[model samples]
Target chain A: MIELYESQRAMRNMRRAAMQRGVVAILDVGSSKIACLVLRFDGSDPSDENIGSLAGQSGFRVIGAATTRSRGVKFGEISSMGETERAIRTAVQAAQKMAGIRVDHVIACFSGAGPRSYGLAGTVDVMGVTVDEQDVARVLSACDVPDFGHGREVLHAQPVNFALDHRSGLSDPRGQIGNELACDMHMLTVDAQAIQNIAHCVKRCDLELAGLASSSYAAGVAALVEDEQELGAACIDMGGGSTGVSIFMKKHMIFSDAVRMGGDHVTSDISMGLQVPTATAERIKTFYGGVVATGMDDREMIEKGGETGDWEHDRRTVSRAELIGIMRPRVEEILEEVRACLDAAGFDHLPSQQIVLTGGASQIPGLDGLASRILGHQVRLGRPLRVHGLPQAATGPGFAGAVGLSLFAAHPQDEWWDFEIPVDKYPARSFKRAVQWFRDNW
Target chain B: MQPLSRKSQSARHDPAPSRLKYRFERLKLTPGFRFCIRVVLPFALSVGAVSLWFASDDNRLAFNQMISEVRETVESRPEFQVKLMAVDGATSIVAEDIRKILPVDFPVSSFDLDLGKMHETVVALSAVRDATVRVRQGGILQVEVVERVPKVLRRGDRGLELLDETGAFVRLANARADYAKLPVIAGDGAHDAVKEALALYAVTGPLKARLRGFERMGARRWDVVLDHGQRILLPETKAVRALERTIAMDQAIQMLGRDLTVVDLRLTQRPTIRMGEDAVQAMRSSNTIKAGGE
Candidate 1:
């Protein structure tokens, strides 16, 4: 954990260096596609009262964007190292070309790897009259880190809440007088192997791993509006191979979990149930995929075509109702898993439990109605927040993770490792004074 | 049966640039690397190549030869050739002296002629006050000159050299009789006081028949000698004013015509006269006769 803390601190330093350079690249390794966006931090006027500025106070603009079909990636985790590296190269190179500038630092995100969240609380007496940055760091270090099992890496550890004595829910408690300083932190851990694979691929590409974030948390940051995040909302990013569930409260992610099933499962179901090729089944699913079958669907027939030699095998027809029947259960299963995750995270206890579904798979027709029915009465389809110079084609729900990664690069949430570990036994003032006396005499 | 997604999926080319090419493209995008490639590299390469090529002795010689050859052809153009020398605003003698001192040949290229040095040489002659040498149109090396006309002839060690108004030597005369129109001054350092000598000579216009020349005695004061071996001594400072005072005395009292040997005006407060031998004798005889008669 200490080693990871050092490395994370090093990465934060690299992020600062990249910010000084004014250019950084964001990579989202998703199950369906690998998206790369080059963000240019122009360090624009901070005093300008322009609310519509890109990424708010951090004026970063997306100068170049490119996406390529992902290969050797499963459930949003790199499965085959070489192929995934190739795909990443394809996307990054195209984006670099479009941007006309080379980017040396990359902040990457992934959604799979079974991310697990832990809430930690720690308290310490204020070192002086008022709480200082050192005291805050000491309190954070005082938090007892869980074992989290072996071969697991901490992805994100953010202080979700702060309390100075009786005052709770304090976003910033520094310079506030208090006898006791306590902090509630949200920490997410994923498989270390997944992180290693990503780091290795990025190393092969000759890029510095400046930072890493969970795709689910990133998507929540992008999809949930300011009000929803302030009140409380759950963003269910229904990706191709997985559906990520994240709950944001007071502008911070409180809980995040991912179901291992998504739109791919629905396509597989259609392929298996309709006795058709996966490609044809995928086409049919996109054209007529839905969770709620109607009476008029039975009359609409879809040609699940193939080029097989057998004439009967080449031509296969199924009604739209049957296609919906095949896809509806799979979608419902994914949503149910998300609901279970929310329930486990105590989503009902939040002040406002708004559920927003967004991702590549969230584009399913009538999914909002179906999600509302299955998950909660409040459900809406979500898209990524618009940013400067983002292509119109990449502004859909599918690009939530990529867009969110850009925002993360521009303005990253502070993590536990961002602070220094204050040395316990520092030299006393008397010793320094003695040295000063010697220097004066000499 | 046709698969609807075939068109979209067909011919999917995975465009992963090679490692070298990808890195090269990135290097091209880097501001430092791009600057090296687009600006520094090209400049350095050209400079290196040129320096390398010219490092060879034969090549250096050839390059220098080429340059000189081009310069020679331009210099030898007919329009640049100065065919003749023309000296104006000078006497024939000064012109001859200018031609003798200048080291140039006719039909020579003007580029090979150093006009500034030629003008300095021409102006070096005492007769020429100033000269400007320029290659004029119609292929002429024209030396425009301003010659100093001698104001007074000084009989010095150089034997009657002509001096201009500022006491600058212009030329020498065979004898003082040749320049009778000019006042003759003879002294150890008389050229330096030509202006005063000339002014004194002009004041003697009334007694021009009796005025001989000025002798600069002890190189401090002037003594104007007349036809009868009589002289008027002048003070060093304001000699011209002293000479004018003497001329007024002469005009009023015929002072120079009397039997007086010298009129000394060296001390402005005192005017003294020395009698001639004849005048002294006559005065002595009259004194004896008057005594006897008394």
Candidate 2:
């Protein structure tokens, strides 16, 4: 194995060890919720061939998970450090209790802060008949590293696929005889400070940092199938504080985007329309929110206690039609924005014909029909895939990233190790996260 | 008597040096040595100053020359001669209308000519299938690219640009390439998988010389074809190994010499072969039954 590859594998193995002892945690610090899953990994002998290839590839099983309502976060930014830390701790402890283990290593995901995408291309001639690992590294380094803004940094810069002369879409060009090799890579950039803030919050919870992924990307991994990923498909994860969209093709995410409006906005709309408290409106929306109202729905009404302490004016009923009327327009608006994002991503231009909807807000009644109409394509409600030993509480769309992070941890995509990192003969630290912990720690 | 007495006294005492002798040893620095040191110090200092001035001037000139050489070399290279194709801060520039960006004496020689880069750029055009880039001795870089002509245009909310196995996506604004018989990838991820299948096809080599179309079954695996639609189902895993096995089977059985469809290799060990429509229906039916029993 190459030196860099070995080192990365060692690091991953260390993470695997920490996760396997029933103490690995995943922290999803989003605008809407701070979810923590303390997963107890069931270890199989790494050298055992049967275990190594249980599913023709690597696999993992999850044992515990938990989530908590977030505070001090607004659209993915940590405004109050102490409050966020408390939320993270609460979620982690709850998950640990459920798993019956103590967790120390955590992999976290975050959404919002306006992620941007860029396309970079590179090429190199194969010195030998077969493309070797060195050739792959050389071509990747040959790609012009784009200049993101001063404070922003590249989080994920991956060679989605490669093409040989006259042939395209080669996943691993190595060991194939080719005179020349070229690669089209998708790069994602985010605010460096935002990443540090998330890491800091997790650190405050006393958990070791294992890895980090964009929330939208994690959702795409769990929601999209191999076929949808191989061709072209878009995943729209609508959470409470933000709606994230990720585009996948060739089993890799090519584009990721997000809008700062989600389930919370719909709840706010319901509260305003019904003239009820925000809490009551939330309960009503979850129970009876609808995008399309029928004649039967118009006659049906519900009773609610008024705020005024007058028993005589206590009960009032609003038709379900009225509720649908208020919710449909807002849902339509969110979908329209999502459609715009897809258009901006040039989604239709891709060979993609399928659209998957996930996340907490995605489960709303009649959302699929509304999304299909607005998105102008086939839309399906996506649920997180089944993994071994997942608790029933974690089966909701709200747990998508937490569950997917578990899967990603089990079967990781090719990282820097899968190929070699071109050494300017310098240490990997040159490329490490510059802002180590949040500047606020000072 | 005095000399003998002094010798006896010295041997008896084995005495330490007297104060006068100790003082003489302490003040060993003499005027002659001091005069020589004082004269040499000023002369050495003057010589050093003169040499430092000349050395600094020479160093400055050398630095200037190196910078100019690097600048000249970089300026001479053609815009696309470098594999990176970096138009630094020139996002507004169009790749097609880049004639003006080409440097006059671009050093095509120094530029590493990677055919793969040219192939990738061409494949990205959605028009090209097979791309070949070559640099002659005279420093002329020639690109001969064959494009995947769209057989059917897929209409969605946004206009679609589809390429065959190579993932070439041509914008709607761009002129369509001449190869129109190539089938387009329709579903999501289809375009990318088609490219993967094509790449896997390259490994097929001699067998690819007999292939017709490669279709991706959306989220499922590939359904490959030989001349006139002979389908081969490649399993999701061990794809490369399966391709190798298929080639071996082709050579051993001379299957490529005949018309066939649905060569199922989903099972790693057992390879199923379905004869093409050109074969006698009765015979094909009999073959399926016989193979099933086996």
Candidate 3:
């Protein structure tokens, strides 16, 4: 835990250096595509300061953006280092060209890596009459870190709640009269090997990994609105090889997990059913893929074009209803897995169980209708929030991960600080001041 | 089942740039590198090329030759040519002297003419007081000379020379008879006091018939010399007034017509005259006879 903590702190320092230089690159490495956005910070807003409606971002402009199809990546994990490096080079080089600048520091997000969330509680007696930062630190260090397996590393550890004496939910216990201080912290851990792979790939591309974020948490920060996050909401980010589920309450992410199944599975299912190539399967799915099938879909046929020597084989077509039939089950299976994770996390107990569906795969027609039936009643499709200088093509739901990574770059500690936890050095507060961690950090 | 993904994907080259190409492009995009290429490189190249071209002696000589040839062609044009020189407002003798001093041949380019130097050369002639040299229309080099009018003649060691009113030498006079009507001033510093001499001459109204010239005495005072050898020695300051007093005494006593040869007005309270030898002998013989009779 100490080792990862120091590395995260170093990455935070690199991010601060990038902010001082006034330029940073955001990379969202997903299985389907790698997106890069170069942002130029034009003002001196406080680091991790909630300056805008979305909590902790202000005075930044997107100067360059590019996306390339990902290679040698599956379920958001780098499968081949060399291939991932080349893909990253392609995106970064294109973005640098558009921005006409050189970028050395990068903040990246990924959706795979098997993230696990843990809730921990620790108590400490106040050393002085009133609790101060030292007592807060002591209580935080006192938290019993669970043995969350050997190979995993803690990505986020935050003090979620603080209680003094008998009163509970004292978000900031510093300088308050209290005899004993007890705190609850949320810790999210992911496979260490996955992070190492990402860091190595970024280094190979001549970039320094300034910060790392789980794409699910980034997606949750982007897709879930301010009110939904404050009340209670779960963000579902369905990508090519994985679907990310993240629950936010009182503006802090409590749990984040990824299901190892996504749009690629549905495309494969269609490819197998129609005896077509994967490329053709993807095109057909985007054109005719749906979750709810009707009688009208049977009449809508999609031609699967091919240049094979035999005419009879090249001209085969599939009805839209048949395509929907092949896609619906895989998408349902992915949602069912999400529902299970939410149920396991006790998502039903939240005050507002808003489920926001976003990402490339969420663009399927009638997805919200299907997700509402299985996930809960309050379900809607979401696109990433708008930012300055974003290209119209990148504002789609597919770029939620990339946009969220940019927001993460604007405030690097938002993902690593465990906002629900109240720590001093890494304070990215969601309910800060208990009054105005209002849009990002209070 | 037909599968054409491989053929289509293989038809086009990979969209991702190679590692070397990407690095090269990033270097190209760098602000410092871009500035080197965009501004400094071209400036340095052009300057180098120019300096290299100018390095050879033959090239330098050829450039200078081209410039001189262009200048010559423009200068030799008809509009710039001076066909002749015209000397205006001078006597024919003075004009001839002026034309002799100026050696400008006809049909020379006006650009070759140094008017300022030419004017100074013409004005330096004793006969010409002030002159202007200019190239007027119709290819004429016009020299307008203002010749000084001779006011007095000075009989000096180098012979008599005509002088203007300001005591400047106008020209050499061959003989005194050539200018018999002009007053003759003779003495070492008489020319230096021409204005005073002219003032004394202005008061010599009654003695005009007998007046030869006014001679400067000791370069300070004046001695009025008449044709009969009568001379009046006048005081230094207010010599003109002393000369007026002499003229007044001569008008009252007709003293200039007597045997008096010297009227010494150097001492204003005492009036003394030196007679001729015959007059002094006659006065002494008459006084001796009158004493013997008494």
Candidate 4:
């Protein structure tokens, strides 16, 4: 828990340095690929005077981008520190070369480590004066920090909503006349070891770790349209080794969770079922993958060429329908797990139920349709918003995490560190406030 | 005992609906609408105040005057005062011209100086192609300018002025003799057509010494006036190519030196030449003798 506070402070300091430098790198370390994007800031402080108009929109532009096949990473967690460091170095170096500027600060996002979310509420008397930053800080400090067991730490503790004087859902309450101030904060915690491993990996690459965000939150920020974010939406990022699910409302990620299964599971299924190599299975999946099969698929034959000299095995062909059959069950299981996560998040309680699917694995045809049927929400396929000077090849769902990290680097949400947490007020366990928050929001 | 037990059950069931009704009544004012009121009411109040203030002339004047006074105090800080101005990326003459055009007062507060307006004023100078004005460290106002490079010298009714490559007015020439190396153009609107004249002069590389100037004809075409009072009329379109053809013909036939007053290449396919008056009369008399002999 102390480490959480330290990491938050370090991240804030690093973010300030990156902003001063006018350029920073955004890295997405996933199971299948490590992507890096170099963003150039135009020196406009995002918090300058237009807080109401430019709430969630960022002002950074991508100047360079590069990606490489990930090594020593599985389920979005670093398995081999040395291998992951090498991959990150390669990606960042390539991106820096393209951008013609070397960057020492990087903000990285990953998905894995059994993300858990807790909602906490805090309230305080405004001392009969107009509410200001200090009051907001006092209220935030009053929120009870839940006992998230051992070996886990908070990744994101953001004030999702604020209420003043019995009125709720206030975005910002400063400069307003209020006698009482209340806040609902969403805290996401992940495995401490996973975060430490990533920090170590980034340090090994000789770059300062500026910030860290959950890949699901970053993807949702990048892919979900403004209305979807404002009303309510969920972004399900299906990567190679993990599926990240995040729920957003009012431009804030209120809940996030991840399932340790992704496209690699389907590829492994195909590899085992067809007795083919993983590379061949991946090729076949990318070229001919689908969740839904039709009668026409039965007539379409996919050649399964083998390196062995055995004529019978090398010359064999299988119907596309058979491939679809092998892939659908695993895909359905992943979606079912995602649905369970969403149900646990009380997604149906939100006013809007739009779900956006994005990530390298989400590129599979018919996934949106299948997701809509399974998740019982309006589903849409999402790709990252095109940033300035981004290459044509980099404008794909695979780069959503990288692009989203860039946006996060530019215009990070006002987090707990952004405010001065009043040191005198310690968190007190108040069960009544928690229940009241739940009732009000849900 | 049975009647008493039945009475307890009936009493317990009777308040259930009323309790539900109480809960519904409590929930009538949703947090969302309350939040809306909380945000909208203050915003609307401020807007109303502003509109009312703007609607009344006296109030508006008082408000604006108060704002200006506050701004003046904040801007008059010693750190915000610009003590010096430095000009870069221009010659001494052009820089002097830029200084004259800019409306900045020396040692004035930086806030009082509208940098955007200053930039526009500097760029409006004939010599300045682009300019950037910024407050540098140490309260120094830095003005960086890209001065236009003169490509041609045009003699106009307003005297000689230098023209850049794009035929835009640059600055008044200090002396015509100083820019003698540059090709000179004259006549109305020739300043705008300096580009075509320059191109024609470029292709006539061998005839540079004999070429004097270009006269813009009807503000459309060019009449290439040479040193020996000989002129070549060039068409508007492809005037460069026509000049090139004339140069080629001159190199082949020495057509320019053959006592001709005008060479018309307007119809590029058939060039017509008007001989000198004396030369035309000599040819006519010689033609009569040749007819008698036939």
Whose DockQ is greatest here?
A: 3
Q: Which candidate order results from sorting by DockQ in descending order?
A: 3, 1, 4, 2
Task: Give the per-residue Cα lDDT of candidate 3 at A102.
Answer: 95
User: Where in model 4 is the C-alpha error above 4 Å?
Assistant: A1-3, A45-58, A423-442, B1-294
Q: What digit string (tens of lDDT, one per residue) describes model 1 on residues A95-177?
A: 99999999999999999999999999999999779887778888998889998999999999999999999799999988999
Each model's C-alpha lDDT?
Answer: 0.88, 0.70, 0.86, 0.85
Better of 1 and 3 by DockQ: 3
- List candidate 1 stretches off by more than 4 Å: A44-57, A121-147, A163-167, A175-182, A273-322, A419-442, B1-14, B18-28, B137-140, B174-178
Q: What would the per-residue lDDT of candidate 3 be over residues A1-442, giving only the tens digit for each residue? A: 4566668878888998998998899999999999999999987575545454535555688999999999879998989776688889999999998898999899999999999999889999997799876677768878898999988988777676789999997867889998999988888889999999999999988789988888998888788888998899999999999999999987778888889998888889988999999998998888878889899988988888888888988888878888888888888899999999999999999999999999999999999999999999999999998888989989998899888888767755433232232344344553443443342353
Q: Considering only N, C-alpha and C atoms within 3 Å, which residue pairs clash in candidate 3?
A: A54-A439, A55-A439, A55-A440, A56-A440, A158-A421, A159-A421, A159-A422, A160-A420, A160-A421, A437-A442
Task: State the lDDT of candidate 1 residue by residue for B1-294, as single tens digits.
Answer: 224563563325767777888888888888988888899999999999999999999999999999999999999999899999998998888888888898687889989999878877888889888888898999999999999999888878868889999989998899778888988888777877888888898888787887778888987889898888898999989888888899899889988889999999999989899999999999998998989864
Model 4 whole-model lDDT (C-alpha atoms): 0.85
Comparing 3 and 4 by TM-score, which wins? 3
TM-score of chain B, per candidate?
0.90, 0.39, 0.89, 0.74
Candidate 2 segments exceeding 4 Å error: A1-22, A45-58, A311-314, A416-418, A425-442, B1-294
User: What is the alpha-carbon RMSD of candidate 2 to the true structure?
Assistant: 52.2
Best by lDDT: 1
Interface RMSD of each: 0.7, 39.3, 0.9, 28.9
- lDDT (Cα, tens digit) per residue for candidate 2, span A31-100: 6777877665555544356344433223455656777778768776677675677677667666665665
Q: After superposition, how far is residue A410 of candidate 3 from its true place, in Å?
A: 2.8
Q: What value does the interface RMSD of model 2 take?
A: 39.3
Q: What is the lDDT of residue B274 in candidate 1?
A: 97
Task: Indicate whether candidate 2 or candidate 3 has the larger DockQ.
Answer: 3
